[model samples]
Each structure stands twice: as structure tokens, then as C-alpha cells.
Target chain A: MPEQLVFAMEVTLNGLMAGVLYALVALGFVLIYKASGIFNYAQGVMALFAAMTLVGIMNGQVPFAHLINAIFGTHVHEFGWSVPGFVAILLTLAVMVLLAWAVQRFVMRHLVGQEPIILFMATIGLAFFLEGVADLMWGSEIKTLDVGLPQGINLWIDETTFQIFDYGFFIDNLDIVATLIAALLVIALVAFSQYTKQGRAMRAVADDHQAALSVGISLNFIWVMVWSVAGFVALVAGIMWGTKSGVQFSLSLIALKALPVLMLGGFTSIPGAIVGGLIIGVGEKLFEFALGPALGGATENWFAYVLALIFLVFRPQGLFGEKIIERV
Target chain B: MLDAAQTTDVQAETLLEVNNIEVIYNHVILVLKGVSLTVPKGGITALLGGNGAGKTTTLKAVSNLLHSERGEVTKGSIRYRGESIHASDPADLVEKGVIQVMEGRHCFEHLTVEENLLTGAYTRKDGNAAIQQDLDLVYNYFPRLKERRRSQAGYTSGGEQQMVAMGRALMSRPETILLDEPSMGLAPQLVEEIFGIVKDLNEKEGVSFLLAEQNTNVALRFAHYGYILESGRVVMDGPAAELRENPDVKEFYLGMSDEGRKSFRDVRSYRRRKRWL
Candidate 1:
């Protein structure tokens, strides 16, 4: 087995892992886009805020510390400041839910019946606001997140030597876990959209806001629920990426990859996001590995956008978008 | 041929009563000025007028679709089943068996025919079984819709889309349905077919209807009672048969003279051809 083939296989697997993360972010974009026509450019910042909030809560930051100190004062520090990872995760989720509710109640509620472009700009405003809030709360420094997931590789075959008729491929356990988690989340989302009353209402709102309101579905409640669910997906993505690298503003930049994924997948498609993410992921990784040497080593930076641009020219409605026929 | 006792009984059950309602749009421009009418519990009721005669506004007021934002019902009240439903939400009105099929079909183009029907039943708490029963009922009334149940509504013809819209409203189990211009864009044959279904629904299922129409002759044929609006006011109101026989209405609207109708038709055809070319 050649070394180059093994390296290519490793890069492909790595790309799949990255693609799963992109899918998670794209899922958030799709959720918000489906419920409200807003593109929610702030989705990346929302994830950043959630991850930052988790870090702040875990480290006994000012607000949480002050609340605890006001109750118990001096003995608060002595009572073991470290919270369980699961508990911190849950608290972070609650905070995300509250933030989502507040965002809908205060920001989006007032902007109802506004133009789509105006709403998009409002989300951009929200993104900057959330980013500032996150920085103020957690400080603009990178933090290591230990979510109790196992680190390092667990190999099936010893020494990465697996030969299948003179072709060799390498596998990593982290890549395997990421794939499994992505698959599970996708399945859960599908079931929730298909079976639940709220899910149907979400789809209804997605189809037409006025009609949904006419049918008695609360637009506000659906918006909050979708944002909260998207927040949950972001938290999961943050944990995966944060554990792999570190929690920082960089995670927000990584989420920008979802835009291209959305372009390829169609803004309203759940399944399309996942598949598009994987394609972008693998394509970028393969490109960077095979062509990075000639391009001076960072082809990953623009690969997704290029693929999305090409897809736009061919399938403007997106891979899974409903065909719109103008009747005028 | 119907009995007098049955006529009295049917008249006694008043389905909708609009009492001196005045609707103003955008805090100015009165659309409906002290408009009032009553629809019996069975058979069709026609609201006839020119484009801005407030006929559509009157229907919107009944459905609560016209509020202060777009238009306000500033005076009087709308009572359904002896209850003042002036402030009722559109969906609540639907739940109470007062569904309005809007002026345009307004079918959810992205959804399949069956899915659009399901949306009509959004407020229904009944389990899937009851919904399925209603779906079957709707399918029986419009067999073409049943064949295209899985097809997206955007692809359906205007006539078929109107059926989907009416079928969707029926899915909510509305006792009294408000249909606004069901024959607006349909061909003459399709118009007759739609009116036939309306008659059938009223007779067979006992579903009450307050239908607003521009075509007086066709509406008078199906409706038991009718109202004529001339410039946002009811100029004439009476039994359908009585109104049909009125020389004044026939001369002005029904086009009793063939020469008058031929000129109108000729102008319409000329405009249509000009637009088409």
C-alpha cells in the first residue's frame, strides 16, 4: 500500500468529520430560515455566545459567582467551584433557551411583517450585539473546553496497517464518533419535524406566515422553539469543535462555512444541509490535501464557497428547494 | 316545491347577520358604509356589485380578516348563531364552523393537496381517524383532487385549485362557509361545475354558504336570496326569483338586451386579444 493513498484516506475521513460540524451549523440556519424567512446571519454568533456562556458558567464567572456569593458569600469558594460537565451543559442549554426567547420577544417580535432584507439586517445587528455580549461576559480570550469526551485515537488494526488488495486506508475513532453523532441528530430532527404538533406548526409557519397565523399557529412560539433547538445544535457543534481545537471566536468563523452549505443545500432543506455539508467537507479536505502543495497550503479557506458558487449557477433553487412558479 | 313549514324553519335559523357595519381602511377611506345583511342557514346568498362596491369588504368583515390595520369594522356588529363574533380571531371563527375561502384560492402552493387539506384541520383536536374521515368526504365531493392528492397545489389548474381551497375550508367541518368569487377565473363550464358543487354541498351536506359573486345571472340561479350593491351600498335585496324577474336589475346588470351584451363582449374580447398579442 502506498503512503500517499493512506494519507488521502486520512484526509477524506478528516473532511467528513469537519463536514459533520458544518452540517450542525447549517442545520441551525435551515431551522431559522424555515420558520421565518430571515437568513439569521447571527446564527454563528449565537453558537459562539452559547459556547462562551457554557465556559463562563463552568468557570464561576462574575454573574454566576456573584449570585452564589450573595447567597453563601465566603463559603461559596470552599463548596467546590467545579460543576459537573453535564450540569454545566444543561445550564448552558437553559441560558440558550432563555436568550432565544428574549431574542424573539424583544428583537424579532417588533420586526414582524417587515421585509426579508430588513429582517436579515436585524439578525446581522443581533449577531454583533451577541458577539459583544459574549466578549463582555467571557472576555475575548480562547478557553479550553473539557466536555469528558475521550481524546486521542483508538485504532481497530495495530500500527495503521490495513491492506485491501494493495490499497490501504486509515481510520480514526474521533471521526467515527462525529459521524455517529451527526447521523443521530439528523434522525432526531427528522422525527421531531414529522411527529410532533409543534414541528408541524413550524413547517406550516415556514410555508406561509399569514396562513399559519390564520390557522391559529402562534408565530412567536414557533420562532422561539426553532431558535432554542438551533441553539442546542450549536452547543453540540461547539462541544465537538471546542474539544477538537479550543473554544474561541474562531468557532464563529467556522460557522460561516454553513452559508455555502446552505447555498448548496437550499436554505429550507434539512436533509440538503447535511448532504451539502459532507460534500463541502470532503471536497475541501481532498482539495487541501491533494492541491494544497501547489496553492501554497491553504485551499480549505475558499473551497466551500467556490463549490457553492458553482452549484448556484446550475441549481439556483437549490438541490431540494421547492420549485417556485410565478403566476403574474 | 318545498313545504311552507320547512321554509319557515330554514328562515328561522339565521346563519349570519351583519348589522350596520362600517369598515374604514387605514383609518381613512370608508370601504363599507353601514352595510347590513342576513344569510339563511341553507342555500346560497349572493353579494353582487362592481369591484369597489364593498362586497369583498363585507365578506372580510364577517371572517375577521379585515381589522384596524388593513380595514376596520368601525360600527355595528357581525353575529353568527346569535353570538356577536365581531372581535373573533380568524382561526377561532374557523373553529366555530365559520370558514372563509378567500377571494383568490390562496392554496399553499408548496404543499401537496392532502397537506393543504390537513392545514384546514389545524385547529381540530380530533385524532387522525376523524381527519381521515373528513378527507374522504372532501375527496368524494371533488374526485379530481383525490386523484391529485399527492401533487403540489402549484401545478393544479385554477379550477382545481379552487376545489382544493373549498375542500380545505370544508376540512375544518365548517357548518357555514364563506366563498368569495369561486368562479372568478374559471371558464364558463368550470364556473357551472363549481356552482354545481356549491349547490350539492348545500343540499347534501347541509353546509351553509354566503357566496359573493360578480355574475348576477349565475348567482341568482343558485342563491335562494340575493343582495345588489351599487357603489358600496345595498341598492336592492329580495328573493332570488323575485330579483331575477325585476326589469330594472335585468336591464342594468343581467343584460336583457342582446345588443348591449354583444358590445360588452366585443370590447372585452378586444382588450383580451390586445393583452394576449
Candidate 2:
């Protein structure tokens, strides 16, 4: 293979890995949006909070340590015992579930049957509140997360590529692992919503709440389940992103990147989220690689948004979104 | 011919009883003002009214679906099988074999026809075999639904969507269904077809119906009993055969007076002098 061709392939492969991460975030958005018609602006913050909670649990840190110390006029942080990563993950999951329940009970319950914009405004408030709580509980510190996932570049791929093309292709082991996990997650989710009784009810609720309720599906139960599933997806995203780059406030900003992804993929589709993520991921990366030098570099950041904007102008319903079927 | 035995049998079994219920939306807009009706077992009871006559509100009150729309029953009681269901959740009503097919054919547009039918079976704990059997039954009744079972329900014609909604309600194995405006937006032929199926379901499946409709002629033709609601109140109530022959119903609803067919202009003064109101 030619040097430029191989380099482009490498970038494309790397872009696909990055796309998987974006899709993971967007999956959380899609799940919540499809079920509740809320855009869930808090999704990125949910990822940040989950990652922070996981880190806090793993390090045996006392929850609300800053408040505890202030009240007592004494220093107390960790419990001085580290928990195993797996146990910590389970604990974090439990916390996420609790969070989901609280959100549905306190926030969503009252807002039932409200306009979409009102529900959306409530989520915006929820995002800020969650971000503040996460900061206060975890003390606004950047923490490195080690979930025992293999890190750094894969030597096997590098050596094999070197043998074939007399050049090494760079690929991160973490990216490969993230890709596999994402694929599995998508398959599991698809199977669940496609086959399960609750899944049908969820889709029914998404389509028409009155009809779903009329058929005996509890809206509250379905909402809680959806939020819990979304929380689980957020946790997965948090783990991957935190492992790549330490858990911090900036991690929540990834939700901003996911906006363009959802716009391309359609907010109501799961597979659209994945396929849209991949398209944006590769398109942005490839665009930057091809035209970066002429444009004075760093076009990747805005390229996805531009492509998504163009899609909005043309196919507003998105790639896989259910088109609004109006009978006149 | 109105059979005396069937009439007495229907009067004996009151499946759903709404006694002088008042429905208020957003805490102020009084939609149903002291409206009352009943659904007898194995009978098609029609709530006949014009637009905004509180027919749908009355049905929603029985099904406990008014709460979601910020509407509530402020007075009187709705009972299913002699048990008060005024404060119950809509899902609880479904569990008790009472479901409402809402106005405007609220089919899960994105779902396939079969999937929409299956969603109606959400509250059923009788297992998949029973559900499958019911699905087959629904398919038998709504043969067109069976043909387009794999197609997205939104793409289906208005008549088909109405069928999807009714068929979905059937999947729950309900003893009584509150069907709202099943004839809306469909051609007259399709309306006849839907009402025919409703008659079949009532006769063969023994499913009771409390259908709200504006098509008085057809509703009177099919319903065992009928309630004529005019602006949040029941102006008249009688057996279908009696209501069909009533002169006021003939003049106002069927557009035929004793002097022969009367246009709106001719009936305007009589409408103002409505004796029942």
C-alpha cells in the first residue's frame, strides 16, 4: 500500500474507535429521548458523575468528605481501604440506579404531560444541579481512573502492519477494547428493546403515551427503567473516557460533541446513533487529515458540526429517524 | 327487531356505571357536567354527541385516562363491576379489562401493526400463548391488519390505523372497550366495515363496547342502547330502537323532520327551541 493510503486507513481506523465513544454517549441520549422525549442535556454530566462516583468508590473516599470535614473541623477523606475495581463498579451502578429513581420521582413525575420544551428546560436545570452535586461530593478534583483495561498501543498490530507495508500503523489497545465493548452493548440493547415485553411498552410510550397508558403500561416504571439503562450506558462511557483522559469537569463537555452526532444519526434511533457516530468520527478525522495543512490546522473540532448542519438543512428527520407520517 | 329477552339480559348486567360525573380540564374548563351513562355486558352502548359535547371526556372518565390531560372527575363516581374506579390509574383499569381506544387513532406509528397489537397485551399476565391466540383472533377480525402486520402503522390508512387501535385494545382481552370516534376520517364504506366488525366482536367474542361517536345514524343502527350528549349533558337516553325513532333525533341528528328532510337553516329556530335542553 502507498504511504498516504496506509496513513489515511490508519486515521480512518482510529476515527472509528473515537466514533464508538461518541456513539456510547449518544446512546444514553437516544434512550432517554426515545422513551421520554427529553433531549437529556444532563447526559454528559451523567457520564462525568458516574466516572467520579466510580473513582470515589474505588479509592474508598468518604462521600461528601469536604462537607464532613467542614462540619467536624477535622480531616477525613478515604476510608483507608481500596475496594476491588469490579466491586466498585457494581456499587457505582447501584448509585446510578438510585440517581435514576430520584430523577424520575422528583423531576419527571411532576412534569408528566408537559410540553417538550418544558421537559427540556427541567433537564437543563437537572444538568446544572447534577454537575454541582458531583463537584461538591468529589471535591472538583481531576482523578485518574484505572479500570484494569489494557492501555497504550498494540505491538501485535504494529509489527504485523510493519511486515506487510514496511510501515507501522498506530492503534491504541484501549480504543480496540472500547470498540468491542460498544459493539456488544449495542447488540445487547437492540436485542432487549426488540424482543422484551417492557421494550415494546417503552416504544409504545414513546410513540403515544395515552395509548400506552390505556394498554396498562405504567409510565413511571418505564421511565425509571429507561433512565437506569441510560445511566448504565453513561457509566460505560465514563469508564472509557476517564481511562483515556482523567475524570474532570471537562469530561461533561463531550455531550456537546454528541449533539452533532445525534443530529446526524437522529435522536430517536439507537443504530442511528452508532452509524451517525461512525460517520461523523471518520468524516471529521479524514477532513482534518486531508485539508488541515491548508486550513491552518484543527478543523476536526468544527467539521462534525458543519456536516451535521448540512444534514439538518437537507434530511432533518435524520438518517434513521422515523419520518413524521402525516395524512392529509 | 328489539328482542325482549336480550333487552332484559342487557339491563340485568351493568358492566360499567358512570353516575352523574363532572370532568373539568386544567381545573376550570368543565367538559362533562353531571353526565352519566352505563355499559351493559355483551352490549354495544353508544355515547352519541356532536364535537365538544363531552363524549370523549365521558369515556376518558370511565377509563381513568382524564388525569394525564389535567382533566379530573370532580363529582360523582365511575364504577366497573360495582367497584369504584374513579381514582384508579388507567393501567389498573386495563388490568380490570377496561381499555380506551383514544380519539385520532393513537397507534404507535413507528411500530409494526403486529407490535402495536402486542402492546395492548402489556397488562395481560395470561402468558404468551394466550396473547398469541388473541393476536390470531384479532388478525381474523381485522384481516387487513394481518395483511399489513409487518408494515409501519403510521403508513397505514386512517381506517387501518383505527383498526390497529381497536385491534390493540382487543389484545388485552378486555371485557369492555371504550372506543372513541372509530368512524372519524374514514370513508362511509370503511365506517360501515368497522362498525360491522364491532358488531361481530360484540356478538361472537362477547366483548362489550361503550363507543363515543358523532355519526348518530350509524351509532343508532348498531348500538344496543344510546345516550345523546349535548354540550356536557345527556339530553336523551333510550334503547337504540326507541332513539332511532325519536322525532327530535330524526329532525336534529338524522336531518329528517316530520315535514321531510330539513336543512340547518330550516332547523335553526327548532334547534334554539330544543325542548330537552
Candidate 3:
């Protein structure tokens, strides 16, 4: 292979891995939107909150520590004993589940049968509320998360590529893990949705609320279940992103990247999220590599949005979204 | 109001009773004004009305589906098997052997025909074998649904979608189905076919029906008893055979009269001459 071709292949490979992470975030949005009509604006902050909660649990930091310390002048922070990585992850998941129930009970329950736009506006309000709550619960401090996931370049890949093409391929172990995890997550989600009884009810509810209700499917329960699943996805995305870059307020901004992915993939699709993430990921990276120098570099930042904008005009349903079927 | 003469003929046990119900939407607009009806077990009762006559509202009120649309039964009580169900959840109503096949054939559009039917059995604690037996029963009633079993409900024809909706309600093993507008947007032949199935289900399966229909002609032929709703109130109630012969019904609804095919101009003055008013 030519050296330029090998370099392009590496960039594409990196982009694909990055796309998996984007798909991870997009999965959260898709899950909530699929089960309920609400487009959860709080999805990014959910990832941030889950990651912060995981970190706080692992470090044994007191929740609402700043307020507690300020109010009491007690200066008590950590419990002085860190939880194991697995245990912390489990604890964070439980908290996320609790959060899901609370969201459905307190916010979504009262807003049932409201207009979709109104539900969407509620999510925007929820986003700010959750963000404030997360900040208050886990003080606004950047924290490095180490969940035992492997990171850095794989030497085996480097050596194998060097031997095969006279050039070493750069591949991060973390990205490799993310790709594997994402593949498994997609498979699990597909299986759960395709075969399980609850999964069928969830899809039924997604299709028509009144019909689903008529069939005796509890909408509130399904909403909480979907939110919990989305919360779990957010936790996974949080773990991956928190490991890549320390857990911080900026961690939530990755959801903005997912917006283009969803726009390209369609809001009501799961496979679309994954495929859309990959397309945006590889397209942006390849675009920057091919045209960055000519365009004064940094084309990667705006490439996905431009491509998504073009997709919106032609095929608003995305690649795998269910086409709107209207009859006279 | 149901008189002793009307109630005396239907000696079968009452499956559902909606008493002098008043439905208000958004807490302001009164939609159902003191409507009352009865669904006798093993019988088909039709709630007949034109558009905006509160046919759907009366059915929703029975199935407790009014809450979702911001409509509430502000005054009356709905009872199923002698239990007050007006305030219960729609899901609970299904558990108590009642389900509503919503107007406009609200089949889960994304789901395949078979999957849509399976959703009907969501509340069933019975195993898959029993549910599958009922599934076969539904397919028997709607063999066309079996042929299009794998196809998406959204892509099916209007008549087939209506069948799918009715079949879905059947899968729930409902004792009383609050069917709303089953004949809407379907051909006359298909409408007759659906009514045939409803009659079969009522006779063989022993499922009671409180169906709302705008096709008064077909409804009167199929229903054992009927209620004529006009402007949110039941103006008349009688046996279907009697209702079909009633002069006012023959003129206004059946589009015929003793004078023979009265013109629209003459029927315009019906409100003043209507005996029930």
C-alpha cells in the first residue's frame, strides 16, 4: 500500500472508533425518543451526571459536600475509603435508575398527553435542572476517572501493521474497547427490543400511546424503563468519555456532536444512531485529512454538521428511520 | 333515559353500565351531556351518532380513555360487572376484561401485524401457548390479517387495518370491547364483513360490544339494541329492530321517510319537528 493510503486508512480507523463513542451518546437520545415522543435535551447532562456520580462513588466523596461543609463548617469531604471500580459503576447505575423513576414521576407524569413540542420544551427545562443538580451533588471540579479500561496505542496492531504494510497503524486500545462494547450494546438492545415482552410493549407505546394504553401497557412504567435504559447508556458513554478526557462540565458538550449524528440517523432509530455516528465520524475525519491543509486546517469541527444539513434537505427520515406513512 | 320497557327485554346480565355521564374536555367544554347506556352480556349494543355527536366520547368514558385526551367524566359513573371504573386507569380497565379499540384504527403502525396483536395480550398472565391459541382465534376471525401477518400495519389497506385493530382487541380476551367507529373509511362490503365478525364474536365468543358507529344503517341491522346520540345527548333508545322502523330514524338517519326520500331542504327543519327534542 502507498504511504498516503496507509495514513488515510489510519485516519478512517480512528474516525470509526470516534464514531462509536458518538453513537454511545446518540444511543441515549434515541432510546428516550423511541419509547416516548420527548426529545431528551438532558441526555448530555445525564452522561455528565452519571460520570460524575461514578467518580464520586469511586472516590468516596460526600454528595452535596460543598453545601454540607459550608452550612455546618464541618469540613467533611471523603469517607477515606474508595469503592472498587465495579462497585462504583453498579452504585452509579442504581442512582441513574432512581433518577429515571424520579424524572418520570415528577416531570413526565404530569406532562402526559401534552404536545410533542411542549414535551420537548420540558426536556430543555429538565436539562438545566439536572445540570444544576449534578453540579450541586458533585462539586464543579474536573476529575480524572480510571475505570480499569485499557488506553493508549496497541503495540500488537502497530507491529502487525508495520510488518504487513511497512508502516505502523495507530490504534488506541480504548477506542478498540469502545467499538467492541458498542457492538455488544447494539446487539443486546436489538435482542431486548425484538424478543422480550416488555420490549414489544415499549415499541407498541412508541407507535401509539392510546392504543398501547388500550392494550393495558402502562405508559408511565414504560417511560421509566426507557429512561433507565437511556440512563445506563449514558453511564457507559460517560465512562468511555470520562476515561478519555477527565470528567468535567465540558463532558456534556459531546451531546452537541450527537445532534448531527441524530439528524443524519433520524431521531426514532437505534441502528441509525450507530450507523449515523460512524458516517459522521469517518466523514469528518476523512474530510479534515483530505482538505484541511487547503482550507487552513480544522475542517473536522464543522464537517458533520454540513453533511447532516445536506442529509436533512434530501432524506429527513435518516438512513434507517421509519418513513412517515400517510394514507388518504 | 332508559325506561322499564327498554330494560325489561334485555334480561341478560349487564356487563357494563354508563350512568347519566357528563364528559368535559379541558375542564371547560362539555362534550357528553348526561349520556347513559347499557351493554348486556353476550349482546351487541351500538352507540349511533354522526360526527361530533359524542359517540367516541361515550365509549372513551366507559374505557376510562378520556383522561388521556384531557376529557373527564365529570358527573356520571361507569361500572363494569358492578365495579365503578370511571376513575380507574385504562390499563386497569383492560385487566378487568374491558378494552377499547380506538377510533381511526390506531394499530401500532411500526409493528408487524402479528406483533401488533401480541401487544394486545400485554396484560395477560396466561402463557404463550394460551396467548397463541387466542392468536389463532383472532387470525381465524381475521384470516386476511394472517396473510398480512408479517407486513407492517401502516402499509395494510384501510379495511385490513380495521380488522387488525379488532383482532388486537380480541387477543386481549376482552369481555366487553368499547369499539369506536369500526366502519369509518372502509367500503360497504368490508363494513358488512366487520359487522359479521362482531356478531360472530358476540354470539360464539360471548364478548359484549358497545360500538360507536356513524353508519346507522349497518349498525341497526347488526346491533341488538341501539342509542341515538345527537348533540351530546341520547335522544332515543330502543331495540335495533324497533329503531330501524322508527319514523324519525328512517327520515334523518336512514335517509328515508313515509313521504319517500325527503330532500335536504325539508330535513333541515327536523330540529323543530323532532319529537325527542
Candidate 4:
């Protein structure tokens, strides 16, 4: 087998792993967008905050200790013990929920019915505010997340022999776990939106705010519910990415990649976000593999944007977006 | 003016009273100038007017869609069931059994026919069984909706969408349904069909109706009471049958003379010629 083919296979595998992470972040965006028409640009920062909070809590940070003392008013350090992985995950989810509820009540509720662009800009401000808050509370330092996800590459098939067969493939167990988690989250979100009463109310609010109000669905309640749901999703994405590459400000940049995924998938479609993430992931990897040397290397930086720009020109309604019909 | 004794006799069965309500849009333009009318309970009331005669604005004010910031009832008040609902929210109005089937038949285009109907029961504090029963009732009234239960509303025809909109309002189980131009932009035959359904819904279900329409003949024929609005003011008010016979209303609105028809045709053709240029 040729060295070129091995390089291509490696890049493809790597790209797909990154894409799964992108899809996770995009899922958070879709949840907020569907429940509220506002584009939540603060999603990246939310992920950062959730991850930072998780690390702070796990490491016996003073502010996390102070927050616990203030709320439960019990002086505690590092939860006084080490909990199981699942228990820690559940505890982190509770914190995310409280954070989401606070943001919606204090920030988003007052900004209701404003222009979408204004809301989008407000989220940008929120992102910066949250980043500063996280930095203040936890101190701006990269931390290692130990949620007990398996580490190190476990290559099932030998690359050298597979390369000899001229059809080489390398698969990592961690990458496979990420793919499975991404798939599970997508299924859960779709089911929640379709089968749950609150989910239906969210969709109704997304379609028409006035109509939703007329039907006695409380807009504020739905907003809080969706924000919390999105926050939970961000926590999951943060954990996955943080575990894979360590928790830091760079994880926030990974969340930013969701913007182009949203552009390609259409902000309203959940499945579109997942598929768009996969496409961006695989496409960027292949592009970097095929054209990296020609473009002086590292074409992956702008590949998602280029693909999204091309899609916008041709299929602006996106993969699963409803076609808008103008009536006189 | 009718004597106070006669007005009291008329007001005894009134369900809705709009008393000298002056609505100003943007605190600048007075859209409804001292508009007043009475809609008797358990009967159809026709608010006859041409375009921009403040008919739609009056309906919106009653529904509480008009905010004081954008538009306000500057002078008077609106009473539903003898209680002033001047500053009530639209959702509160629905809860209180007053629902509006808006002018444009604002159906949720993305939802299926059944889903749209389910939305109408949003305010009801009933179990699934009751909602299902009401859903069945709506289907019985508009069988076409039942036939297309799984179809998205965007694919439905204008007439069918109108039925869906009406059915959605009916699902709310309102005591009084305010319909704004149910006949707008429909075929003549479809318009008659819709009007027939409205009459049936009113008589069979005991739902009172206050309809605003430009088509005077159809409205006057079905309504029991009528208020003729000219330039945001009620110019004439009487029983529907009597107003149908009034000479001025007949000449200007309902029963146009042959010469008036000729002038109407001449104006239409002149507009067509201008479009050709």
C-alpha cells in the first residue's frame, strides 16, 4: 500500500472524530433556535462555562466551595469525597440547569420580542460576559477533565497489514464512543421534540410567538425550558471535547465551528445539524488531505465556511429546512 | 337618536358593547374615532364597512392585540359579558371564551391539520379525552379537515384553509367568535358555503358571532343586527332586515342602482387601462 493512501485514511478518521464534536455543539444551537427564534451566539461560551464549572467543582476550587456554601450554606470542600462518574455527570447537569435558568430569567426574559439581530448581538455580549465570569470564578487556566471516558488509541485492525491489503482503515475506540454518544443525543433530541408536550409548545413558539401566546403557552416558561435543555447539551459536548483534548478556551473555539454547521444545516432543523456536522468534519479532513500541500497546508481552518458558503448559494433552505412560501 | 327607553330595551340582551372607543395608532393617527356599537347575544351582528373603515382595528382592540404603545383605545372601553376587557391580554380573552378567527385565516402552515386543531385547545384545562372529543366535533363540522388530518396546512386550498382556521377557533369552544372577513379572497360559491357554515355553527352550537365584511348583501342576509360603518363611524344601526330595506344603505352599500353598477364597471375598466400603460 502507498504512503499517500495511509495518510488519506488517517486524515479521514481524524476529521470524522472532529465532526462528531462539531455536531454535538450544533445540537445545542438547534435546540435554542427551535425553542426561541434568537440565534444564541453565547452557546460556545456556555459550553466553556459548563466545562470550567465542572473542573472547578471537581478540583475543590474556593468559589465553587463558596457557591455551595451560599446555596446549601454548608461549608464543603471537593464534595467531601470523590463521587462516581455518572453521579458527577448528574451533579454537573444540575449546575448547568441553574445557570441556564439564571441567564434566561435575568438576561433573556427582558430581551424578549426584540429583533433577532439584536438578540444575536446580545448573545455575543453574553458570551463575553460569561467568559469573563468563568475566568474570574475559576481562574483562566486549562484543566484536565476526568469523567472516566476511556483514553488512549485502541486500534482494532493492524495498520501495517491493512495497508498491505490496499484497503487500510484505522478506528479508535474513543472516536467510536464519541460517534455513539453523538448518535444517542440526536435521537433523544428528536424524540423529545416530537413526543413531549413541552416540545410541541417549543415548536409552536418557534413558528409564531403571537399564536403560541394566544393558545395560552407561556413564552417565558418555554424559553427557560429550552435554555436549560441547551445548557445540558453544552455540558455533554464540553465533556466529550474536554476529555478528548483537555478543557480550555480552545474548547470554546470548537463550539464556534458549529456556526458554519448551522449555516449548512439550517438553524431550525435538528437532523440537519447532525448531518451538516458530519459533512463538515469529513469534508474538511479530505480537503486538507487532498489539497493541503497545494494550499500550503492547514486548509481545514476555512473548509467548513467554504462549504457552507457554497451550500448557501445553492440550497439556502438547507437540507431539512421548510420551504418558505410568500403569500399575497 | 333612539330614546333612552328604547336604547335600554335594545341593550338588555347585548353581549358586547363598544362605547365611543377612540383608537389612535402610534399615538398620532386616530384610526377609530368614537366608534360605538352593540352586538346582541345569540345572534349574528354584521359590521359593514369598506377598506380602512376601522372594522379590523376594532376587532383587534376587542381581542387585546392592540397595545397602547402601538395603538390604544384612547377614549372609551369594550365590555364583554358586562365586564370591561380594555387592557386584557389576548390569551385571557380566549380563556374567557372570546376568540377571533383572524381576517387572513392564519393557519399554522407547518403543522398537520390535526396538530393545528389541537393547538386551538391550548387554553382548555381538560384531559386528553375532552380534547379528543372536541377534535372530533371540529372534524364533524369540517369533514374536509378530517380527510386531510395528516396533511400539512400549507398544502391545503384557500377554502379548506379557511375551514381549518374556523375549525381551529371552534375548537376553543368560545361563547362568541369574532370573524373578520371570512369571505375575503374566496370564490363566490366558496364564500356562500363558508357563510352557510357560519350560520350553521351559530344556530346549532349557540355561538354568537360578530362578523366584519365588505360584502354587504351576504352579511345582511345572514345577520340579525347590523351596524353600517362609514369612515370609522357607525352611520346607521338597526335590525338587519330593516337596514336591508333602508333606502340610503340599499343605494350606497347593498342594493346599488343600475347607474351605480355602470359607474363601478367604468371605474374598474379605467384602472385596468392604467395598468396596461
Candidate 2 local lDDT, A180-295, one digit each (tens): 99999999998889899998888888988888888899999999999999999999999999999999999999999999999999999999999999998899889999999899
**Candidate 3 C-alpha lDDT tens digits along A1-328:** 7788999999999999999999999999999888987899999999999999999999999999989999999898999999999999999999999999999999998887889999999989988999999999889989999999999999999999999999998999999999999999999998998899999999998889988988899999999999999999999999999999999999999999999999989998889999999999999999999999999999988998999899999999888888998887
CA deviation > 4 Å runs, candidate 3: B1-9, B272-275
Candidate 3's C-alpha lDDT? Answer: 0.91
Best by DockQ: 2
Model 4 misplaced stretches (Cα beyond 4 Å): A1-10, A60-114, A155-174, B1-14, B17-29, B67-75, B230-235, B255-262, B265-277
Report how far off residue B219 is in candidate 2 (Å): 0.7
Lowest summed lDDT across 10 adjacent residues in model 4 chain A is found at A76-85
After superposition, the stretches of candidate 2 with alpha carbons farther than 4 Å from their true spots are B1-11
Q: Residue A40 error for model 4, in Å?
A: 2.2
3 or 4, greater by TM-score: 3
Question: What are the DockQ scores of the candidates, in order?
Answer: 0.33, 0.85, 0.84, 0.31
- DockQ value of candidate 1: 0.33
> Where does the lowest 10-residue lDDT sum fall in candidate 3 chain B?
B1-10
lDDT of each: 0.81, 0.92, 0.91, 0.80
lDDT of 3 by residue, B194-261 (tens): 98898889778988889899999988888889999998999999898889889889988998889798
Write the candidate numbers in order of decreasing DockQ: 2, 3, 1, 4
lDDT tens readout by residue for model 1, A207-252: 7766665555567788999999988988887777777778899788
- Candidate 3's DockQ is 0.84
